[model samples]
Target: DVAKGYILYLEDISVSFDGFKAINELNLYIKEGELRCIIGPNGAGKTTMMDIITGKTRPDQGSAWFGQNINLLELSEPEIAQAGIGRKFQKPTVFEQLSVFANLELSMAGEKGVWTTLTATLTGEQRDRIDNVLVKIGLIEHRYQDAGSLSHGQKQWLEIGMLLMQNPKLLLVDEPVAGMTHQEMDRTGELLTSLAGEHSIVLVEHDMDFVRSLAKQVTVLHQGSVLAEGSMAQVQADPRVVEVYLGE
Candidate 1:
């Protein structure tokens, strides 16, 4: 049966690397259409948790589900992606040589070979989809430019546009605003907040000010488990969170 109003579920998830627990019996739940921010100190198992969800890493013990029916543990990385999970790493990875338009075209949901997909004529609906994503990512004006020619922040937005092309149900974004200018950071925050209700976003970031700008529910991880979860104000006031993370 489906877990009503939830998009993801992780229970008793644990993994070890060379006898060091990277994830220790972690449990998390993501509500449908929710925008959740995850923050943590280094080695706090944040990446590991995302890897587990995307099938990039396997755990020694746990159950993960997409919605209520899809068993994430039984799927491969590509399978998980095809099942509607999209991940964007800290670094922007647009096709530098390709036009912004072409990059999004290449990322469209399909099973066709890349060459065939690129060469095939796009239906009117497909073209409209690309246009819509360009507007959403704030790159409509740069659609014809080579991805490499865009500034760092624009490149990040383009990469996000690429993911939007696939229409994923859940998105795992890691440090999206790293190395961005303050203006870019604000724009990025606006973009992410706008997308929240339509797509469940799990954002893992280290920028306190950026995180505060989002003002969404926050989860703090430590020693392979969640140490704190609340509003930014509540967590910032947490003495344990301060002692282990903010205090440093």
Candidate 2:
């Protein structure tokens, strides 16, 4: 019953490193086509939780499910990825020497082998998809520019666009707006919000303003478990949340 209709679910999940319980008896659920925001001060098991869901780390106890029938805990990292869960790291990993369009072309769904990838040709649909993603991320103007020449914010959007090529069922984005201009932050918020109903998104971000702007539901993690869950306004008003952030 862990999954139900959730795109992702964790029930009584616990994990340890040495003697420290990184995640203890954690329970979380994310509905299909919903964008969920997860926030915490630091070491609240956010990364650990993502690792567990992606099968990069196995939990010491409890269950993790992807959709209705997929047992994420039983799958390996590659298998989890192939199952339509895409993860973006805190830093952009786009090919700096490649043009934005080329980078996206390289990310299209198919065999990733070097020979096959380099020789593959994009069909009409794939080209249209890339063009649409370019517009969505607001990188249409820079489509032909080398990734190295773009601003940090543009690079981030390009990386996100690369992820879009996979047509993932769920997107796990980490600190997406960490380094960017205020204008870029607002645009990034818009980009993420636009993807909600089409693709379930799980964002781990420290930017309160950005979270407030984009998050419909916010989950606060402290001491490796949920301290509160609500809208940004509701959670900010919670005395427990205030205490945790202020160390009171």
Considering every candidate listed, which one attains the maximal lDDT? 1
Q: Candidate 2 local accuracy as lDDT?
A: 0.90
**What TM-score does prediction 2 earn?**
0.96
Residue-wise C-alpha lDDT for candidate 2, range 140-196, written one tens digit per residue: 999999999999999999999999998899999999999899999998999988988
| Model 1 steric clash total | 0
Model 1 misplaced regions, further than 4 Å: 246-248
Local accuracy of candidate 1 as per-residue lDDT tens digits, 17-100: 999999999988999889999998999999999999999999999899898789999999999999999999999988999999
Residue 131, model 1: Cα distance from true site in angstroms: 0.1
lDDT of each: 0.94, 0.90
Quick one: RMSD of model 1? 1.2
